[model samples]
Structures are given as C-alpha cells and as structure tokens.
Target: MLHKLNLEHILFLDIETVPEYKDFDSLSDELKYLWADKTKYQRKEDFTPEEFYERAGIWAEFGKIVCISVGFFSFKGEERSFRTKSFFGEEKEVLIEFKNLIESHFNTPYHLLCAHNGKEFDFPYIARRMIIHGISLPQKLNLFGKKPWEIPHLDTLDLWKFGDYKHFTSLKLLTHILGIPSPKDDIDGSQVREVYYEEQDIDRIIIYCEKDTVAVAQILLRLRQEELLSDDEVISV
Candidate 1:
C-alpha cells in the first residue's frame, strides 16, 4: 500500500511547543489551579504542579506551538529531492501560516499529513491549537465525521506497530534501530522548552524540527524499501 502511494502527496512534519507562559508564576491564579488539577495524576507526590509545568507543552491547552517544520518529496524521473519549510513566531501567526499552506497547496482528498506518532500527537495538537486560536481547520485536519479509513493522516509509529496495540516506539529509538541518521544530534524534545524560553534560540529549534521532519520522510522511504535521502537531496527553504 505504501509503495502505491505517491510520496509527493504526503507532507511530512514535526512541531515544537513550549508552555504558554514563561513560568508557573506567570499564569493567572485560576489557570494555576487548573494546571494543578490537570496534571494531578502525572505529577503525583513526586513533583509540584510548578515543577511539572515545564511539560505543559505536551498538552495543547497549556502550551503553544513554537515551530512547525514540514517537508515534501519531489521527483524528476528517477531522482528525488526533499524540500522543507518552517513556520515560527507568535503562536497565532504560526498557526495561520501553517493553515494557509495546508489549504492552499495540500487541500485534496488525496493529500496526507505524515509524522512519527502524528495520529496521537502532532495532528491533534495542531488541530486543538487552531481551535483555541479560532482558526478554521483546513480540510486535511478536520476529521469531524470521517470514518477511520477516510482519514488522510499517516503515522510512522502506527505503521511500525502493525496492529500491536501495546507496542510503542519513540521516533529517536525507531530511527536508531532502523539505521536512519539520528535527528537528535544537537537538541531533543526535552530541551525544546528551555531552548525557546531560556536560550531564545528559535533557529536552533527550527533546525531540530526540520531534522525530525526529514527523518520522518526517511522513515517512510525505508518502509517503502527505497533509498534513504542523502544530505545533498534535502533542501531547507
């Protein structure tokens, strides 16, 4: 099935997010209480809500997207090239730009959005953020009444699971086991909040995000039993 699908029709993507506020104290009193309640089970007695706040980015309600990097394949005869683009800045602006890209170019029944664990994370995160910002979802992201088979999203992790519901794999670990180049050479998801808030290095995060996006494309190619993309074949725009 993967071999029959056109790589050019899929948009491979990854996103970076940070807590909406700079710190726990930055949140309003009401929100502070809400955060505590929202994370009670995860935090348990080991850490306070303030300490667990760093991971707020995992949830769309408490976090905001800092960057969204996307890549797509283009082919000329037997040659293939991958092009990447990133949207970053204010959260609303980033969401708007990403939405525009989806609606303008990839808005077809045949188009698919792919990511590593996108079905559980990236896809729904973007949709929730868009709703919070009052941005209308692009057709690709809007899955209101679509049957399971009608959904046009691909998750590499899901494919790797192959119907094993209890099995889980991290993108980093999967890439390592699959012999694809690692995307975590510099920074990783755990450091994204610090990079965005403390170091104020969005470009670093963008590069990291793009690497993950490229890695996702590479994963698909591997699944299809094709060649991995060499550095020369990847272009960041």
Candidate 2:
C-alpha cells in the first residue's frame, strides 16, 4: 500500500532547535517567570529553573529553530536520487528562507511533508517560530480551517504507531528495528543546545539535521518494502 504513493511527492524534513536565549540569565524577567511556570510539571522538584533551562528547546514558545534540513527524491535519467538542502543561521533568516522554499516549490495539493515526529513537534514548531518572526505561514504549514484529512503532514513515528496512541517510538529506535543506518551516532538532540551556544557549530547541526531527514526517507522506504537509496545517491544541494 505504501508503494502506491510516489516518493517524489514527499518532502522529508527535520529540525534542530535551541533555547531562544543563550542562558536563563539572558531571558527577560517575564520570560524567565513564564518558563518556570510552563515547565512546572516536567522539571524535577529539586532542579532549579536555571538547571532545567537546557530543555527549553523542546518548547516552541521558548525555543528557536537553528536548522531545518529537507530532503526529496528526484530522478536523473532512470536513476533515483535524494537531494538535501538546509536553512540555518539566525532564526528569522532561517525561517524566511525555509518559508520561501515551501511557498515556491511545495505549496501544492500533490506534495506532502514528512518528518520523524513532525505532527507533534517539527511542523508546529516551524509555524510558531515563523509567527514569532512575523513571517507569513506557508500554505502547507498553516492549519487554519483544515480538517485532519486535509492536512498534508506525515509522521514516521505515527506510521510506526499502527494505532497505539500510548506507544512512542523515537526515530533512532525505528531505524534500529528496521535495519536502517542510525543518524544519531555522533551527537543527539540532547547535546544540540550546548553545541550551538557553546561550540557555535551550525554546520555540525545542519549535518545532523540532514541525516535525520535522510533517515526519515529511508524509514518510509523500508515501510514500503522498497530499496533504500545508496550513499552515492544522496546529494547535498
């Protein structure tokens, strides 16, 4: 059944995010109070707000996307190739560029966006950050007045769920179960904030983002019982 959907119609994507400010001390008094309130249930009882600040990246309200890497399958003469592109740097610039790409090329009925846990995380995070940056939401990301079936977003994690809402599967776990190569070998999402703020390594984050995007595509192919693209077939553009 999965084989019936055209691979070229799907855009596989992943994003890396970090706290809006470099540290809790940098946040305004209002924002600091808000963060503490927002994370009241999640943080441990003994952990102070400053100690728990590292997790701000998971919340769209307190976080900003540092990288958004996208991959899509295309053809060159009878051979299939997957190409990836990334938008990085400042939050506003990255959101603007990503929105332009979506508006220009993917704003159509036939194209779909896929991510690891996008329905829960990536898709809405991008939309919220775009709104914060005052950039218009792309047609694909805008959910206003759209029914569930009308939304074109696909989630690899959801697909793996098979209707068990209580179950959660991480992308890394899915890759392992399906025999796809793992993308989290070097640094995982937990380390992204430190890498971005302390190391100042956008390139490393972009590389990580692209690998997750590629892993999403590979996972989908595995579900479809199709051949995974060879390393040579993945081109960065």
Best by lDDT: 1
- For this target, which candidate reaches the highest TM-score against the unseen true structure? 1
lDDT of 2: 0.92
Give the per-residue lDDT of model 1 (tens digit) for 140-182: 9999999999999999999999999889999999999999999
Q: Model 2: residues >4 Å from true position, as ranges?
A: none
TM-scores, each model vs. reference: 0.99, 0.98
Instruction: List where candidate 1 sits over 4 angstroms from the true fold.
Output: none
Reference-based lDDT, each prediction: 0.95, 0.92
Candidate 2 residue lDDT tens string, 37-57:
998888859778999999899
The alpha-carbon deviation from the true structure for residue 105 of candidate 1, after best TM-score superposition, in angstroms, is 1.0
Query: What's model 1's lDDT at 171?
Result: 91
- Return the clash pairs for model 2, or none: none
In candidate 2, how many Å is residue 92 off?
0.9
